[model samples]
Target: MANPQLHLLELNAKTGEVFLRLRKFPNIILTPPRWEDEPLLIPYLNDPRVCDWLSGPPYPYTLQDSKDFLARIKPPADEVIQHLKDADPAAAPIIVGECPVWSIREVRGSEEVFLGGISIIRCENGELMGPNGVDWENKKKREEENNALAVGDPSIIWTIGDWLAPSHHGRGIMTDVIRTLLNDWAVPRMGVRHVWATAFTGNEGSVKVFLKNGFKLVTTHENHVVVKGKMRGLHLLEWQYEG
Candidate 1:
């Protein structure tokens, strides 16, 4: 469970943006995505080196794709938060699982530049099952298997995913960000346990990021996905909270 004191956050009422300070690196912050971030985000999505490993969005990612994606995952309105507060004043204003994405940025002088993005979603049986095209029976079986491990309800298992801009590569920025998110925010604020992640076999950099952040390899799916007409393997990783 989240610390009650950290439940409600201060947000910019006009822009609906909330800023989170990085524990060790106070200059960096995790903020809500804004319309102006399209340019910063789209380039990375369009880059073959980056998008090839990712699952969704057609390559040569367009302005429209960026617009559509942001719209789909936008956080709830202020009125929704107010309603939740009215119902339960003590509850966290924003449910971590409900809001799936946050933009990672660094404060430079008076401006903050978008560096990358981090996301988490609730899954069942360690699988990314969403509202569209779901298999309930399979999900049930997976949940049973997951529950048997004494890891709590599999249906509520939260998975973490991230992507960083190419320009910021090799700086260890993402590794540090992932660690802070898991330790300071996700575990403490979201009460996340058994967080999951997957990386393509060839993507050694991402594999290192997960491993360094304390995720253990659980399984490998050979040729699980096809990208650019070639088969690719995937390694599944998990981080379980003991405390």
Candidate 2:
């Protein structure tokens, strides 16, 4: 059953500010990345403890890398205003990669501090193949398989990914973030039926977060990623909206 209280907040069309309201922490908001966030993002991306688990933004992340990432993930300022004015959450435009990414920030007095990032990518007619063995470089074969399965234009599936600054660890912040995104945004606003996520085997914290948000364990992929010269396993989880 859907939670009646789970609703998306209205975006301020004039200011172009998008936010997800949290019951416990009203000051925390999930919004689009801003130009001022580059500095806050750089240190987190460069942190070995943080970057090792992520698939992109090469080691020793730089300012240029941060700039490029912001550019790629954030939509144009004018487009943001338009989407907010439309008053339809699902109508918000995503930048390149067809993924909607947002910055998790905590409002402190007059300032908002960047805490982390979250994103969801929509994949249509794609199987929940374990993440380990697939050769993503072979785009042709993957496309063929997807096209074959998409004959009738099947329902869209979504994959979620997130990262938080080391400073925010152990605060239960991400757990709430995941829950809010799934219950409020992904399922209700975006209307995604199935949502998937992957976490490295040793990262018990992330696995717990997904489980708390109702994601069931699907499979484990051995040696799914190489972290700091060593191979690591990955656990894939899924959440299906019954409504």
TM-score of every candidate: 0.76, 0.77
User: What lDDT tens digits, residue by residue, belong to model 1 across residues 63-88?
Assistant: 88888877765644233334334555
- Mark the regions of model 1 whose C-alpha exceeds 4 Å error after superposition: 1-16, 77-96, 124-155
The clash count for each model shown is 0, 0
Q: Which digits, one per residue and each the tens of the lDDT, describe model 2 over residues 104-190?
A: 888797777888888776542133442544554654555455445431232555678789989888888888888776666665555
Candidate 2 residues lying further than 4 Å off, grouped into runs, are: 1-7, 11-16, 76-81, 87-101, 123-154, 227-230
Scored by lDDT, the top model is 2
What is the Cα-based lDDT of residue 58 in candidate 2? 70
Please state the error at residue 113 of candidate 2 in Å. 0.7
